[model samples]
Target chain A: MEESLYREIEEIIEKYREEETPLLCVLQEVQEKFHYLPRNVLGYIAKKMNVPSSTVYGVATFYSFFETNPVGEYVIRVCKSTPCHVQGAFNVLQALKRELGLKEGETSKDGKFTLEVTSCLGVCGVAPAMMINDVTYGNLNDERVREILALYRR
Target chain B: MAKTLKEMEKAKEKANLVTIYLDGKEAKVPEGITILEACRMEGFHVPTLCYMEGLSSWGGCRICVVEVEGQPNLVASCVTPVREGMKIRLSSRAVREARKTNLELLLSNHPLDCQLCDRNGSCELQELAYEFGVREIRFGGERKTYAVDMSSPSVKRDANRCILCGRCVRTCREVQSVCAIDFANRGFDTFISPSLGLPLGESVCINCGQCILACPTGALSEVSHVEMVWDAIEDPGKFVVLQTAPAVRVSIGEPFGLPAGTVTTGKMVAAFRRLGFDRVFDTNFTADLTIIEEGHEFIGRVKKGGKLPLITSCSPGWIKFMEHFYPELMENVSTCKSPQQMFGAIAKTYYAQKMGIDPKDMVVVSIMPCTAKKFECQRDEMCASGYQDVDFSLTTREAARMLKEKGIRLEEMPEENFDDPLGISTGAAAVFGATGGVMEAALRSVYEISTGKTLEKLDFYQVRGLDGVKEASLEINGMEVNVAVAHGLGNARRLLDQVKAGNSKYHFIEIMACPGGCIGGGGQPIPTNLEIRMKRIAAIYEVDKNLPLRKSHENPAIKKLYEEFLGEPNGEKAHHLLHTHYMPRERI
Candidate 1:
């Protein structure tokens, strides 16, 4: 509800005013700016675009990439696809969970780390892949996963 | 394909006919039509579930799959267009087996508790299961179970019983344009839910219950008040009084095996009497009273330079829609309480005091053809007489079910009139069930009162029928009063948007939330589509024509109520009891 946030949202909405399918693009930009889609911001966008709030919420929940809840300072999405599973992705997931002291989709108490198990990150050639923020780490083992977490912690 | 001699004889109708083989018989049909339409034209009955008549075809449910020649896979006939020389088989051995497999998969995830469901007999999915003779589940699997949502006073949502057909989702978005609910999440976890998975009561749902009518199963239903009514009736110290809405009299017979639109008013009353109600009254009496209040409000607004266009507030769904979407126009809406609430307010004060019955012990039950009435009766302001104005409200379907549970056949019961005092209503009250009935009834009284001359033709044909939006102009006392009538929330939105934009040029408007007014309300009989709604509208008009007193102002009981109790139409006591207020709501 801050003045700056309102002005920024208005600017984002204005940028996609001419696009054919602007809702998802507008939502992605908003999410990128705020780390997640705020509930009140979704309602604001619906009012701005003359669309129902239900529709904005529907599109927001339909895509897994968009998060409605706030993420931690660092998000760890371990790949759980077939190729990664064959390469001991479960061990990598357990390592990350133990290192961050958080279960899947849970943020740590200090809000420093969050762990999630996602589908294929499309780096199956290297297998046992994981994504932190936007960086992808492949051929990951238990020790390498802990080392990656330590690097982020520093 | 082999061309039969009899098929050739049936194909010689038109010169431009296209030839297609249907079930190996060479038949000629029209060009550029879907295979389902072509098959239907050929006198073939192809079963369908998700394919509604007016909606855009969604081939989600493969129950209507048919075998086509040279096609490797069976095609959904509802979405596939027919081509010239296309050979189609509606019921082949392979097609039947594939349909059975598809249904088995749906049933595997579906909970098989039809006996305990609300839509047990009337459900489309249940009927298809019976047709397929699904005895045992060949493909048993883990079923999807969800907690039932009963937060809304009007609707109840059970996600476990949903078939993921998207009928309710489409109906909410396409027909009503409320868009309060939609398909959320991805495959396997996909279910129909309100926006952000909020309870329907918290969402911008008008509680229209059209989704309940569109649902193919028991996933969506009205929040029932049947048991509460039964408990009140069983209490020895309580005097239970019943009031049936005007729309209920015309459509309540559908669940009792009588045809749609059958006017079972007399039998409905008799059934209520047999059900142990001490008094059986009519909501039409208060519907007439609404005319007096709303009509005066309109004239006052026009004369005093108040809000130009006065809108009717009979429908709670429409009232909520206006509150959420068009809050700026709240002043345009008439403050008159709906007939159901008006009847309750009068029943507790005037009727109870007359009979020397204590208001606390008098339980007023309303049998309405609407689900929103259930929510309307529970509003915080409805208790104008210390006790709750209406103790309970039951839908037409619920009332019929209670009658059947008591072993009472509506058709077998003899004709009986509504009880005295509160039961007497005029023809103007009877037409309140249809879409334009409110506008016509108001004009019938308003025109006569203003001009001091009777209307020769009581029927205002211009404002009648199933049109989504209807407009008419009347000259009362040399003043041109332009009026419009809109039924269905989608149409109401369109009309209201025009009004909000300052483009509307009417002095009065009538808006009903359901498509064909209260007769086609959300809680009406199952299969309440366009055709059935039209029949109910016709029956409403027929009831109007047969009555001797055809104007609200001429109703002696209403006149006596004003003479003895409430002094005038918009008097201090009348406004206190008969009028209500509205508040703006969150758009989300």
Candidate 2:
């Protein structure tokens, strides 16, 4: 099953072989298709692209766009870098942690939500920002976090 | 002593101050400070190779170049001083390219010998090469070649792999004040060498071996005594024994993925036992022995009017500095060999006779955090027994690499105890890895001897710190004893100057060449800085404080060595085995 999964990832990667930014584009495509980039796919891409495994790991680790492990139905990413920090991002993170009942980098026991802190989303003027699933939520506050998290609950 | 506040205020007004931009934020820096200093104050780090604290900046390696908006080219921030309103960009494309090119140039000449190089994993040049994305060396040039100089007892110098960044020269001159090593010849043929191109041992070079720490590559390393040791072990006739320095326990863990300064004393012993050594000992045992010898020597000096303000000769780097810069004060140095060598000398003679093993057959391997002990073990005077005392000396870093190669994870192993007699130590021995540890250890013993009573409170809080120079005075036996301690060669020079000028009078003084005693020794690890050194020093002290015993005089193993082997601490046999003499260095 793992070998077959690698074969499918390779096919998806080869689909955009000629693109200049194949890594970024392919990574985006794979994430859009599977919700999270698989570790084996990144390893396979590193071998096929002739790049260092560390470099590929660094790229995957650096941007919050990629994930090497599985995520739950809803992945909540709170901006925690300097700009967001100045605009009460800690409160937003706390709100998410309280709402989802999960700490940063941890998934809820029910597999309904996963929470994380990211560097930035280039939305400093909007103050505290978060990305829930595929859509970005800006100008977030403690109450707004509650309202957004309420929409995701069963 | 101050006359008035107005006079002090006037003096403060003369201080130089300059302002500069760091990542767009402005920082005020003192006038004579580099632009990098200003940037660092604003929490911006400009990566550098040729810049070391307490050493003069030589803009040779372009690693720390930054762009000034009005300036045509990037300036090396480590050397270039900040001007008022000067705007600098630390993350510019041109600056990055220059650094990348510089690394490429260095790599082009550097031999692809990383696999076997002692500095392989911790090399700064290798790290920068990877960081700059150097896929290949574009330039093709004939690499320089010269015979590897292992003539010195302490260090080995391989000129082939030298980057000529002048770090060793700066460390030798500006920090150590030795000036034994200097850049020789013209560009393209430029290399670091002793005066008149003599081998290090033959020249005025002191066997301090601090250059081993300053060097970025395998150009300067401790001569490996491992081959001779492996032979002794393979012969099946020898009883191979190993002893490790105190700092080794704290810093060796880093190479095995354990955090730096994590105490792994028990695990270290377990690994040594697993390595097939017949007995695993602690250099702390002899560090305790050093305190007893050095303490008695101090009392003898005070009573017999031999020499006042006796400086420690334990650090090979400081010993070299005295040979070059303070040759007249060579008499002021303690005559005892460092704990590592002292342990080896005794193990071959006293311990050998006790264990019923032939001195020739016994292999004494010392695991030290010092590169200088590599030279110390090879000294002509070290062989008190019929055979050479220490067959091989491995740095803490090297030992860790060996463990990794053997697939022994320190974290996986359970904590174990050291072998019976030679492995026992006191808090005094354990603290020898931190700054001012020797002075504190000596006081613990000497103070007891002076008072004719045991000390309940062993901690000498006054001297136990990370400061460069620490001074204290104590009243013992109705007499005042003044002591001073300094770590790092640059700091040692400052303390030595006052004593030389008759401005200060210290009965006993301790100095370690590296920043924080053995914990900050040159052979320990890379990125050994103020913060890291402090952490390791704290770990050493923690090991000391947690130990059940805290005084050197109380160690049962040391007492057993005296009773069953050497007879006494400073006995004739002890002197023959452990003590060594120094010589006047020649003009550079």
- Which candidate ranks first by TM-score, i.e. highest? 1
Q: What share of the true interface contacts does each candidate keep?
A: 0.60, 0.00
RMSD of candidates 1 onward, in order: 4.2, 24.6
Model 1 docking tier (incorrect/acceptable/medium/high): medium
Candidate 1 colliding pairs, count: 0
Candidates, DockQ: 0.63, 0.01
Writing each residue's lDDT as its tens digit, candidate 2 over B95-173 gives 8898898778877878877888888877888888888888887976789988899877767899998988888877766
TM (chain A) per model: 0.90, 0.88
lDDT of each: 0.89, 0.78
The true-versus-predicted C-alpha distance at residue B473 of model 1, in Å, is 2.1
Question: Best candidate per lDDT, number?
Answer: 1
List TM-score per model, in order: 0.94, 0.73
**Pairs that clash in candidate 2:** B153-B375, B154-B375, B208-B316, B208-B317
